[model samples]
Target: MFEPVIAPSGTLLGLLQRGRGDGTLHALAAPRAAALTALNQCVLHDPRHDWQVENRSLYYARLFLDLGGGLEDIEAHLFGPGDDPDADETRTGLALSVLGHLASYGRDDALALLRGYAATGANWAWALDELALRDDDAGLRSLAGAVLGRFPATREGDAALAAAVRDAFEPRPWRLWAEDRRVSVGGRVRAARESGSFDRWQRQMRPTGPRPDWSVQSVFDWAQRGADGGSALHVPAARCLGAVAGPDDRPLIVETARSGPDGARCAALHYLAEAGDPAVLDLVETAVADSSRTVADAAVAAFERMCGEAAVDRARGWVHRPDALGASAAGVLACRGGGQDEELVLGALRETVRADGPDAPLLWALADGAGRLGIGCAAPVLRHIYRETSSSQLRGRTARALAATDPSFATGFAVECLWDCEETTREVAALHAETRDARVAERLRRLAADPAEEAEVQTAVRSRIVPQSPPF
Candidate 1:
């Protein structure tokens, strides 16, 4: 997938594309033509950084409903000339999702569109999955022939059908087909189901990696071999070590942590760190300074996993170092440190943003630390990161930080955050956004009523609007 061109933080389209709550407020206030145009752009293009996790379908669907928008743009986009339905699902997943939400909102046209697409669209499975949640039995049943016909009466086709049945995100439609009265439909589906079951069982029975009875040396060797093959099997190999390694095997483990092959070294560090070996911190610090970037990264990650008091003490001492270990140390402290370590965390946050800019990977931990520590002075920095950072996940973390630190959050970013592309951010907005703003109350009501809204978000909305009974 290509990186989407995000609009400047100032524009209404940018705000809507960013999934900001203020975007919704602004769009509602703007001319309906302008609002629908912007909403259509988002629905057709999909502005989310991570479509699978971030939410825009419900937000856009609600906007379409409010605008009384027709489905022509979406329909044309889905069935447009040269559009490959069988290509990557990213192209049409957002549009299909939006239609799903619209259908849930009682849009018969949207329902019809989904039914039509499921019968012939390239990404028919995704459309079928969406319909499985909302479409009636008759609507689903009618499409069985078209869907089943996609697979031919051959071994390869039957195998593909079994894979599809096995991997389906929603099984209601397949289950329904399995019970169909038609021999062609029900029989084929049943055979596919059986094949899928056997496939799963065969997979379970297949031997993979070292077994529990494998020697520690053998496990490390397996890890080394996997590493040689360009696979990072050390993570699971470390788990195998836990099962296989005994008291006398500490020497071998430590040897690997000190200077083993890249894969074995990585696995050993992970094992020792998770085992909470007292000497693991120093070993990690040493590994972080190693010449190999892979070893250094593994070391840093292993160190961060160390949540003991000793690890915090080590972080305090190493926070001043200007290297990957220093950054990881600060992150460890930020995540696991207490109020006493606030200054260290703050120093790291400012320095990281200064050196690496808002998009720095380290800022995620530092931002969360700022929030957990209630560093009121860090709100400005958090807000800057929130606006300038292209990462929605990072922006969500920044929103959480601002909520804890920014006193004006209830009316400021919190309101805009209600429409944030990330559900967690919207949940934050629902929990904290002041209802005094006219839009907040209405948004909450719409959220409460929208069948497509996330349950957590709606639950948060209900908590705000539904009055609590007085204590006895």
Candidate 2:
């Protein structure tokens, strides 16, 4: 999927897209028409950069409930002339998930829409999964005929049916159909169940990679062949080497790490670094300086895996090199360096953001290091990253860092964080947000009572409400 174009963080649509808590606060305060428009736009055009991992369903569902929104837009989108029933899950997964959350919250219309889609929509499996969680047995059983009818009685059709049963995210409906008194429906479902089980067993029993007794040279050849086929099997090949190679093989592995085929060099670097061989560091330095981007990446990654005192000592010398290795060295220190290394970590944090902007992957480790070492001065940078970056996961890490280092966290971002799209972020706010604020108290109570809130967030809310011991 292409990267979504995110609106500026200040706009209502942007806030909603980012799943920031402030989006809810703003949407509620804005004109209902404008808020609903922005909300509908997000639902229609899934804004998450990584849909499978980032969450926006429950967040959008709550807004729809608050706004008394209708399902006309969602219905039109799902069944519209332009809609493709066979489109990938990314297209309709979010909308279906929002519908599921709505159904769970007792929205009968949402449940009805889900039932309609599950019976006929292209993304029926997703809708079916939603219904399985919220719909009654009767509601689900009623659809088995419509669902099963999609497959014919022919051999090809039966195989398709088997694949569907095997890959289903929820088996409640299929299991229900498997017990139907109607032989046509029950027998087909039963057969599909058996077929799916056999397929799973066959997959488990299949052997695809190297086995015991392969020579070290053969292992290197295997790694190279995998690389040639566009598969990076070097890491596993290195593990195979551990089983296959003895002391006599060290020279060969060392030679491979120094100057060998791209695949073998990558595997040897990974293996020697993992084994903590003393001579491997210089080889890694040489590989990092190589012209091949792939080799350089492997070298840096291999360097990051080193965890000895010697690695830390080497990192101190390489920390100021102003190259990829230097940046990685800083991340190494951030993850494993001591409190005395706070200045170095802070410098790396600043330099990285200044050079590569907030979205740079390097900032993830440096940001965590800032919080880990309690560098209070790092709070401003962390807050900047929190506000500007589009990545919710990275934003969550920044919030955690802010909690540890920012003096104003309780009254500031913590309050907004209560409504943040990510559950872990909300949990963080629940734990540290100052209940002294009227909004915080109200949000805490609402979360405590809301069935939709994650259990972890509710646990944190309960702890804040009923402390270990009441006022002494």
Largest lDDT belongs to which candidate? Answer: 2
Candidate 1: tens digits of C-alpha lDDT, residues 228-340: 98888888988899898999999989988999999999999999998999878889988987998989998888888887899999999999999988988899988999999
Residue-level lDDT of model 2, residues 1-472, one tens digit each, is 5578889988999889888988999999999999999999899889887887788999999999999999999989887775576577677788889999999999999999999988888889999999999999999999999999999999999999999999998999999999998878999999999999999899889967554348999888888988888888788888988888899999999999999999989999998998999998999899988998888998898899899988887888899988889998999899889998999999999988899998799888998888898999999999889888888888888999999999999999999999988999999999999998999998999999999999999999998995447687
lDDT of each: 0.88, 0.90
Q: What is the Cα-based lDDT of residue 126 in candidate 1? A: 86
Score candidate 1 by lDDT: 0.88
Give the Å error, residue 328, model 1.
1.4
Q: What local lDDT does model 1 show for residue 12?
A: 78
Best TM-score among the predictions, by candidate number: 2
